[model samples]
Target: MKIHLTSVLVDDQAAALHFYTEVLGFLKKHDVPLGEQDRWLTVVSPEEPGGTELLLEPARHPAARTYRDALVEDGIPLAQFTVDDVAAEYERLSALGVRFTQKPLETGPVTTAVLDDTCGNLIQIASRPR
Candidate 1:
């Protein structure tokens, strides 16, 4: 009935953490070491600390790597995050040296922009007229 957690495959968990937290403005919710080199890492939006968590899962699985690579090759975003204003967020992120695959594009009542996560995924930021 409700969503608790979701995941985005990351090539490097540490780098993903930095980008998701320092750049994307998410807060770390969970960080448990799973093995010698991997950890069960997750992050939540600062505005919604108790909301759904996003797992920065390692993309060690071959299938996951292939799937992510294909999506990137096609310039398709692997995940999307809602923001108050896509254009504003795009500007803020761009100032931080983030590379955007697609600039903010308005389509009807919604606006969206796609940016590389730096850890091997294209993430989209979107906003709808409110």
Candidate 2:
């Protein structure tokens, strides 16, 4: 089976959607009410419209709290996104006022950078030699 969806835990779904779409240039595909204030929101790559969905999940749950806290405490990265040009993407997002934890730097075969999502998640942007 193909991987159709992957979830990212966020403190606020709306804020995550804004960051993913408005800031990162992703496109929103589905956003339906899940009940109360909860929503089943998703984003897709602009280049691959229906390829995969990034589930914007709330981190208020006990399991999510534990998992996110553990990662933050250990200073470990939470997720990585590959880009064609990390430096350019980094600059573009920086201009949009995104907070970056680390500047872009060469790491062996890959050049990478890191940023905070403001929702207890560290996002990594990387590019490898072609």
Highest lDDT model number: 1
Question: In candidate 1, how many Å is residue 101 off?
Answer: 0.4
Off-target runs (Cα >4 Å) in candidate 1 are: none
What TM-score do all the candidates reach, one by one? 0.96, 0.91
Assess candidate 2 and give its lDDT.
0.87
Q: Write the per-residue lDDT of candidate 2 for residues 12-80, one digit (tens) a residue.
A: 998999899989888999999998998999999898997989889877778888888887766566878
Q: Tens digit of lDDT per residue, candidate 1, span 1-130? A: 8999999999999999999999999999999999899999999999999999999999999899889889998989999999998988998999999999999998888898999999999999989565
On a 0 to 1 TM-score scale, where does candidate 1 land against the true structure? 0.96
Q: Rate the local accuracy (lDDT) of all candidates.
A: 0.95, 0.87
- TM-score, model 2 to reference: 0.91
Summed backbone clashes in each candidate are 0, 0
Would you list the clashing residue pairs of candidate 1?
Answer: none
